[model samples]
Target: MVHYADPSMKYKLSRLNLARTDYLFSRDAAEYATYILNTSPIKANEGRKAHLQLLTKCAAALRDILVFGQACTVHRNIKN
Candidate 1:
């Protein structure tokens, strides 16, 4: 019982940490996206593509962060 409880507690803590990390990453990504969009001087087609690529990367990073948060939460719910 103690073993199970310990594991569960650890999982919960991990989940919370992951969620916080995700939130931070998401915030940073959004900021980066804004910066790229605002400062990029991509007027040509290729430049546009590059800008879009940066936006896409930011989106992907945010998505991964969210996924990690979800996984952490799911694991946190498991009974030891």
Candidate 2:
């Protein structure tokens, strides 16, 4: 049984047979989520054109976040 800092959040976390990794963020999780989501494991029932539009939006948003986030970080460092 596992516990959480939040009393209500505490629950029996499943210890399934799976590969373990130090999922500590430090950029790993972000990059992994971005990469994995791009593959979109959930095959949607959307048609070809619809799927392409969805992917295009996802790619654009991902690009914007990376570009703008880097710019903001550099700006913050410069101000500091």
Per-residue accuracy of model 2 over 16-79 as CA lDDT, tens digit each = 2122344444379889888886776555543323454576754344444444334333334566
Residue pairs that clash (backbone atoms under 3 angstroms), model 1: none
- Candidate 2: segments with Cα more than 4 A from true spot: 1-24, 45-80
Give TM-scores for every candidate, taking all chains together and pairing residue i with residue i.
Answer: 0.38, 0.24
Candidate with top lDDT is 1
Q: Global lDDT for candidate 2?
A: 0.52
Where in model 1 is the C-alpha error above 4 Å? Answer: 1-5, 43-80
RMSD of 2: 11.1
lDDT of each: 0.69, 0.52
Tens-digit lDDT track of model 1 for 1-80: 33554658878887999999998899899999999888888655544544546667533344444343343343465676
